[model samples]
Target: MELNQRKGKVMIEQTLEDALSEVYLQISPNILESFPKFRPPVDLYIYDQAVAQVKKFHRAEARLGTEKQAVVATFARENLLFLLRDDYRVYAEHLSRKLGLVLVEDDFKAREVSEIFFIAFRDRMDVFLSQPKIEPFKELLRDVSILAEYLWTDPCRVEFLTKTLHKEYDLSVHSVNTMFIGLGLFVMASGARPERMEVVNLALGLILHDLGMTNVPKFITDKTQYLVWRDRGSIENHINAGLKKLERLEINDPTVRQCMSQHHERLDGSGYPEGLRADSMSMAGRLCAVADSFSAIIGDRPYHSSKVFNEAAGTLIADKGRYEPALTRLLVGLLKEGFPGCVGEDMN
Candidate 1:
């Protein structure tokens, strides 16, 4: 079973001695005795099989291992030794070409935003949340301004949005979608060109809207059943905690502060942290409240399954006076147009 490098070519067969020498040289001594009948110049197919058999007992330890180690463990362990010779190189090259193709395809899809931007945003969020002082929050505001510039000028491509929605896990995904929804609403409502500072503030509020949840214990956050009264109270306080943290950070913009503080406030005075009614709510605060609530209804939550798009929309509409009716209608319309409902199966 000679393995040929060129497709469809035969591989050279080898004696047991030749196979043993090659095998021993390539593998560790601890694993060598397991295969005593090893032959040299053996068919590449048989060689691959032998290597595979040995690997079955020796698992690879690292996520990224050497090519030779990968080849031996993958193809060889499966007993396809005939692929060892030229076939191995050919297969490696084929895989390389395939990876290159995939990367090119991803580049085409990712033209609107770079991976670097997302990484930077995530890192900045971590720093903003962890900083014991106020300076980092200010720095975070600057970085977020740059991020907003990218979003406002270039805008995320449809594919970029789809990919991000699919790739992100729960909390991050919710945060990103809320930012997009809030920004869209701000654009529609303001009429004026979105000022860079306003966009940055909006982005910061959207991203950190749930930051206080970090204070909530995992047991409470992850409870699949309805939270008990005490737990429920704790959960409610997360909003207050978030506002206090922002206040400590010296975030002085009333719109920004209200966006964070009143996101949970209802028009009926039923909401938390003072529960100021609609007449007293700032427009920014109202928009954030609507966006945050709508996104949450459509998104999967700890104790509840995600509501269907229409159902979630109806709930928002039912809130009516509690939320701005016109804005609610626009959001429902956006949902109807098939932007993936904020929650449920992967968007793509």
Candidate 2:
């Protein structure tokens, strides 16, 4: 029985690849009336059963509100259903709703949703980085909007994501971590409920703040040794590089532009790219600075050892006049209050 259970787990793991290829769409309001004319663009499958037997009920043969439909809805409720990857926009509303549900649900369901969403989101970022096209950029914004909504609904997701964040540094993961941390900071700082668009734009800025780093060569970014002046110059150029990419993509959102431009800028005129002082920086810029710095410190990179929650937060606190103190203190509060037992867990 143990062997069979292991085999079942393996099989499920194997099938997850195919499952991730599908997405979720909103159920049509007038399914019976819209049939034949507005059929599912791709073959539809009840995702729960598809793992064992990849059977698909064709759009042509199946009725909209039959047993299969019921099964599909059930699978969706259970987080077992998905639609074709290419047809992601076909049912984008449905996809967002399902993701929202998973985000606020139990730990197990949230983790399951995060694993799937992270892979897909990372791949989406990779595509945009590689191609640097308009469509992919827009898709990335939409994905971040969904992410922002998750935070709006449950701010504690920051602590949850912090606990689960990969200790090793990867640009994509770092960007995501920054988004969660930065957005959480924003939520905390803004006592009154912020506008929906404000959160969405801020989330986009935080996640894509490192977009310019993609332009820098891997040798410099991954260097374990001390970076020489020339290497440092190239690294600093990522801001300009990122701005250029945004220009190409025609992204004109003020918050996003400010974040990418000012994430590297410091409060005391000690940072690069612009060397803007405290009064010169925007709130968005200051928040990104703290979030980006804290994320880098906690994640294990080639040149730096990883710090636990307390150590990382302490480092930020110690750095006088560099990062915004209010923001830094809010982060510390989040680490202590948001995460139960975390204060003692990494004390050693």
Candidate 3:
């Protein structure tokens, strides 16, 4: 499939170069103009075209090699519609069962997988918050490591990845942005002797910090109205549960533990769990706290829509000693500079 725009009109073409050297108009410029408003069923047209083209070119092939071509022809004819509709995921699973070449999304290419994993981690946060299971949490941690390595090695990939998984959910999007922001701060602050492993650990911890809520019921988690005292208590348990789960994983790294454990802890000894003061918290933990809080304030939640970046920054700064003031200022500055588009009021 290829997309090109000519004379201010977009064209999408599908090409099949097997036994049947087939080419088809998957989408015309007219159809492209209606996208995100009126999505036409061009995938069906592509499927029909593939079938007709294959039959026109390779109906008499009978040998083993030809048999393989027939199989490819059949797959293209039968699955083209599904593939175009983002249903390749379903077909890939079916093909995997038969030990065939499972089709993978181009957006999920090796260079893009890290970003996809990051987005998936955020999407799975609701599950993690509700179920708080061990295995899924571990998987989330693995994704964190993957994304960190990708970001550290190829910073440019982050922009491409972010552009690809453009989700409507604000919280999930905010989580990805926060991970980048936090990691950037870590890299910048560490100066000459940046500990790469520590950065990865911090990323994992920051990404999955909300995993403990999986045990909470939906009524409590999704409550739009003010949560009752009991519901609030249950919600608060997520933080402790997240820490306990991390401990069970035997993550002895203090930076990782503190990032998860003290993200909610305030500098004024008013925070939860231990209520540790400024001296008690690790630098990583303090950074995570600022990142998490700032991200959350500017993110759409079940209770309230997201605030503008300036508004969220002001709120964070107002909290003052409750959070790391300097770090909060740095985060606010980063958001302003790096993601001017993020602070807008529009949900999309």
Q: Which candidate should be chosen as best, given TM-score against the real structure?
A: 2
lDDT of 2 at 265: 89
Highest-lDDT candidate: 2
Per-residue lDDT, model 3, residue 217, is 80
The parts of candidate 3 lying over 4 Å away from their true place are 1-117, 123-138, 155-178, 191-194, 339-348
Q: Residues 58-89, candidate 1: write the lDDT tens digits.
A: 22232323554455444343323332322222
Clashing pairs in 3: 128-214, 129-213, 129-214, 130-213, 130-214, 130-215, 131-214, 132-214
Model 1 whole-model lDDT (C-alpha atoms): 0.55
Candidate with the larger TM-score of 2 and 3: 2
- State the lDDT at 198 in candidate 2: 91
> TM-score of the candidate numbered 1?
0.58
Please, what are the lDDT tens digits per residue for candidate 3 over residues 1-348? Answer: 221112111111323322221232222222222222222223322333322332222221123254643443443333332223233333222222222111122222332243335445555564554555677666666556555555555453343332233224443455565665577556545543344576577776666666565557877867888889999889888878877777776766777777778888889999877889999988887888877776776666777777776687789888878988777776566555543232322112
Candidate 3 overall Cα lDDT vs. reference? 0.53
Off by over 4 Å in 2: 1-117, 154-159, 339-348
Error of 2 at 118 (Å): 3.7
TM-score to native of every candidate shown: 0.58, 0.68, 0.58
